[model samples]
Target: MKEFDFIRTLKKLSPLPWERTVGNDSAFFKLKHKRGLISKDILLEDQHFFSSIPADALAYKSLAVNISDIVSDGGTPRAFLIGLGASSNHFSILSALFESLYKYARQWNIPIIGGDTVYSDKLLLSITCLGDAPQNPWFRKNARLGDYLYITGTLGSSAWGLSKIPTLGHELSDPHIKRHLYPPLYLDFPSLFKNKIHAAIDISDGFYQDLTHLLEESNLSAVITPETLPLDPSLPPEAKNTALRGGEDYELLFASPLAPSSRRWPPNLQKIPIAPIGKIIN
Candidate 1:
């Protein structure tokens, strides 16, 4: 079957509100009353790149940023589109970047159907990934006051690692360095929903910003215990505050009630284990 045929068969109605697709062949589907419009835009600059980052990994990171948003809402990535800005001197570097994109694209079984390019003095790139939700996309606003909160991985290390340096120009290749480079993507979210989580959202900006989104979405307030939040092992004792507020961890922060047997929640779902850091209240 054609790719479109495969997509058409995947959509299903969920209890949450969602926009209807005109057809699977269309370019993008919009939010009728939903926020999960596909093709999320993410921008990057020289500061965002490192000389040691492989093009494949850069492409993966670039693409993962957008895909993270879609999948957090239970959307399936269908393809990608890019907006490129670079100079004649950097064409080869940029070329390798996109080559890296295709690596994950193939791993993800997605397509790069369209994009635009322009000349600039330096590098600036944006990736817009198209994804579809089988059910209504998850929203941060729906977090209820009594719901239990969870995160897919530890926080703080990505920025924490970026803040520190090594001697003799040797880059650290430890877990913290890997966390800084490639964050854990919650690809197994379908299994997470089996436990009846109340509402969900992914952490993007910083914990404060993300938690604000959850409260905004649910129309509730939360009191999170700092000590209970998952912290990176590599974080300096002082960096604990940064982990609380530093962003770009890209892990899923979701809410669920304590299950009859919380034991059933997957072992890989969290790095530090899902602790009830706070309670949603009016």
Candidate 2:
């Protein structure tokens, strides 16, 4: 398909009320608040993914990382714009990508407004996501001493899955491999306590390294009980260390005051399994 055809296809898929398709040079969005959050993440062919990965999975990830940022800030994702660069003549790949992106957009209730596409040597995707920043969104600098550091879901699974991707083809459907290819849309957890969390970040760059970012942003330190890490039980022993250093888990690492014993978080999140693994200090 040509560039215009691709744009038309996207317009057909986007049914959100705020999406305005014509008479304007840019897509229109409705922002309920004065403050907004905008974030971008780029995926390069060789550096970010191998050539063998499915186009659909790559498309899903292109938007997922950006969604991770919006919710991490305790904001609700409203819309996005995608920039695509590709040299391949296979228009079917482009179709698959658009379909995959639309699928995720509907699941998250976010819309793809507008973007530019170009021909390049390899597949390249740049996504810019916009959202309404909460009145009291979580910030890295808000971490305070004595607040418990908690993480939702397991770590190291993405790293483990990435390691196996080379040997296994796109058709391979292992759970760990699926985790790496399709990170969960965990925005629900952040939305539950929107203005209440102390500090928050998605564990995209491994748990420990991202924790360092939180500490640096807050100018505070933390003491983690290594034994308390919520590691993936399925990871092999040799890959255990990846739990701390492997990136791309995309789980939320957040800080909150200790809750009362009677307090129960949204039980719907039970499937993701939240855990308190450490405390901010110094």
The TM-score leader among the candidates is: 2
- The runs of at least 3 residues in candidate 2 whose Cα sits more than 4 Å from the true structure, single-residue gaps closed, are 1-20, 260-267
Model 2 pairs in collision: none
Clashes of 2: 0
The C-alpha TM-scores of every prediction are 0.77, 0.90
lDDT of 1 by residue, 138-253 (tens): 66665666777777678888767666533211154665666666766655574456435666766768778888888887888877787788887667788886787887788778
Over 4 Å off, model 1:
1-36, 50-53, 165-174, 258-273
lDDT of 2 by residue, 1-282 (tens): 654565455446554422344447787778987899989998988899887778778888888899999989888888888887775443557667777787778877787787776767777888999998888888999988888888888899998899888788654469888899898677776667754588999999998799999999999998888888889999999889667899999999998875524264554555777778888889
Please give the RMSD to the true structure for each candidate, in Å. Answer: 9.1, 2.6
TM-score of candidate 2 versus the correct structure, residues matched by position: 0.90
